[model samples]
Target: MTTVAAPTRRRGLFATLGDIYHERTNFNFIGRSRIWLGVSSLMVAISIGALLLIGLNLGIDFEGGTQWEFSVASGNPSSTQVREALKDTPARDARILTLSNGGVRVQSSELKTADRELVTQALSNYSKVDASAISIVSVGPTWGEQVSQKALIALLFFFILISVYLTFRFEWKMALASIIAVVHDIFITIGVYALTGFEVTPATVVAILTILGFSLYDTVVVFDKIKENQSTLGREKGDSYSSMVNRSMNQVLMRSLNTSFIALLPVISLLVVGSGILGAVTLRDFSLALFVGLLVGAYSSIFVATPILVILKEREPRFRALRDRSGPSVSAVAVESVVLDEENVMPAATPNPNDQRVTPRARQSRRGKRR
Candidate 1:
């Protein structure tokens, strides 16, 4: 008997691309892992509960308070000692924080003109402090409330506009998924503030909005790619909508990473260098939120938005058909063989028996002429 050799398997371009796409679909970090989603969601719930109970610690910008920064000689002056020295001042709700350089910063709520003078006089008891170092900044409570309202309005408007635009540009499924991802990033950022007890200010609000915009931009890019792939791959056999979406997401994953890295550079710099050079606490707060939000946004774009979209699109009839057609047993061979002619070649017209039909009058005339 003669021995026969088995044919070696050859991979095609589409097969290689499909393997890459399928490999990305199983990403445990950002893919639809039940364990990760459950853990993250539980943490998010805890953070939300803490936020509800404690709320945000609104800063002078939002609560209408006075803040004074004094640079005293570096002598490890305790916060308690500073507070005690300024106890005689006529400012209520006073707080003293120790600066990195052993200096002191004081913040108080509602001080009169003479009260400011008394604060200055009281600070003289501490180590050599210049009078000009005690500059006071104040705002009225009514103005603070107005600022708070405007911030809320702007956020609401931003969300509404984003939702409408996403829906128009892509689909309602994508819009809903993007908005949910936004909410996820926002809540996590706010929760970090609540858990760490960071002061929320106008600049913080700006940072939050900026993060939302960045997150939405990232999600939109992914969704736009998904939309293109959906239109192009809708008729593909043995490929469900879910698979197409996953493929689209994988294709753009690198682009998302590159974009996020570029955006995070400046934010990280502000967090590190700006904080040290300028001694501006606001930069630290804003950058902290931005950094965390950026990370969460990237994650949410992949896990939250795409998974939710898969769930939503699966509800459609056409998607259901695609899903039914895309069974595990289904092979590329089957897909190609079934749709290859329609896809790569034109269909030949079949002769119709009814096409030979003529009007009754013409048939009757023909019969009479023949007779």
Candidate 2:
């Protein structure tokens, strides 16, 4: 007795995860660009709304304040109680937070020496500790305002330099697309923070700047591939500029995913272990900002950047002619039919030989050759 051959359908580990590392997917990024645009627009609108309505919970770094630091030895005071105690003093708008390391941070408006003493006394009474256990950090409003102005200036300069560099490397269309994607990432990240009421601190500002660089890197990767493909192999018959952009994104899809995932792993670990477990608020803030920004940055790079590039490039005389001839309704379908060869990993559009009609002369020639 003999066994039958195993079915070819059975695949190993690499084949199961969408073959993401090995095979290219024919996902029509540009075909579904309208959906992406709609989603991004809606997100941007919601983000803008949150920013307008809720605003960020600015930390002492951004909004000048008087901070009274203390650790509880025995008892605790609720934020409401602390605020009530300070209501009669200059630290009237006191906000209290329980630190992760079993500590208490009392942030408030500027306090006079007398008010400060009153706060210390109140905290001492609440915590059952001596008044000497209090620590104070007072930042002038001028410093906070200056920091804010400097951050804005840095962001502005970053945009200008990035635009110039991208324009030089790729083209104005790609530069525009990348800028739009970066802006989308920024607004989405900021909006999420605003909506969540996360404390916006100097660490958060640093994270945001870092996110800008990460987003630009992702955008440039996609753009670089698109530029190379468009210049080299995009002249194939029945291929549209939109499809080429989509194809380029697919080519480097796994690379972007891997890079983002690798980057996020440590950030997530810091958020969970270093921040949550170890009571590192700075790590929490930085990692949280990075987590949101990296995700949004990846999304905008693939969906927003390439799609906008296609839309912009399609307005050009060459691409306009191509679009007119291919027709929008049918071009995407045509592009989808062109499969990427698995073995060669390149675009294939050779017409089916069987689909060609054999005329009388051709049939005679074939019969003669056969004989």
Candidate 3:
């Protein structure tokens, strides 16, 4: 009797690349959701702890203080010079900052008119400038409170709009998942601000809102893909809901990463070149928030949002029935015969055709056309 060879084939050089970069990846994301959720839980917990303990470092705009700005033409003005300039005045011990245009910004508690004039003269004399050259602005606590209130209102309005839109556009489950992911990004970003002690300015508030939009956009894209795949590919392939979601995620993973990476380049330039090298303090506040938010937004769109959707959708009666009746399709367990390799490849249990619950929409349409 002659021994027969079992079928085996070598993967092409581009196969792995195609699998990873072209949405053919089989990364078990839905299967390993517990790990992702666990990691996110830890991050959220730490963020909550930081918020409760350390708290955010609000900027002068938020805290309500007097601001003095003046430029120096001759020498390189340091924070030390600004401190010394205020040393003799009631505004001494103020927070000193270097502006992008070689100016100094000093912020301190509200000062009396006489004290303000005295401080102006001190800064003018220290910098060898006229008293008229120094400019002062004062903010009351009421203004800061108003800003806080407006920011809160904007955030609330944003949440409401997102919830309503997602609920109608897809389903309540998708809306819930998107909202949870946004909330996750917000807590993490705020926690980072608190932990790093970065001053929370109005620009920071704007950046936070911008990131929420970015996060939502990414999540909606993924959700849309999942919805498309569920109706078409999932029905044709007899894939369970979780498997279908995983496929959809892999398909869009590269696009999400590329979009995020391209977006980060400009924000990174603002952070490093504009802020660090050019010494624009405001750019640092804005770019840092954008950078962190973009990264978290991308991650939540993939790992957080998709997994949560799978969990929610799998509980539906239709998806649950599909999952319970699941077995490897004949196409998934294809076997081939090869002359070079003698290996026995054990295929998975084949699915019974009668047990398949989902009929492809195309097939249904064809049947209706025939009828």
Best by TM-score: 2
The ten-residue window of minimal lDDT in model 1 covers 333-342
Q: lDDT per residue, candidate 2, 130-151, as tens digits? A: 8887888888798899999999
Show how many residue pairs clash in every candidate, following the order shown: 0, 0, 0
RMSD (CA, Å), candidate 2 to true, equals 8.8
Q: How accurate locally is residue 33 in candidate 2, as Cα lDDT from 0 to 100?
A: 82
lDDT of 2: 0.80
Stretches > 4 Å off in candidate 3? 1-18, 72-81, 84-88, 99-102, 232-238, 327-371
Using all chains and alpha carbons, the TM-scores for the candidates as numbered come to 0.77, 0.83, 0.78
The per-prediction CA RMSD against the true structure, in angstroms, equals 15.3, 8.8, 14.1
Top-lDDT candidate index: 3
lDDT of 3 by residue, 1-371 (tens): 22344555655546655655765555566766788899998999999999999999887777898888888869888998788767878988888877776888888887888998998888988888888988899988889889999999999999999999999999999999999999999999999999998889999999999999999999999999998987764455456887777777777877887889899999999999988889888899999999999999998988898889888887889888777666752224322211122234654455565675767665344354444
> TM-score rank, highest first?
2, 3, 1
lDDT of 1 by residue, 1-371 (tens): 22344434444557544544444322222233355467668768978998999888788778887777777655677877777787666753487766655566677887788887788767765757767766678887888999999999999999999989998888788899899889988999999899888778888899999999999999998888888887776566677777777667767876887889898999989988876666678787789889989988887887777777877888899888887877752222222211121223333456555566556754344354444
lDDT of each: 0.75, 0.80, 0.83
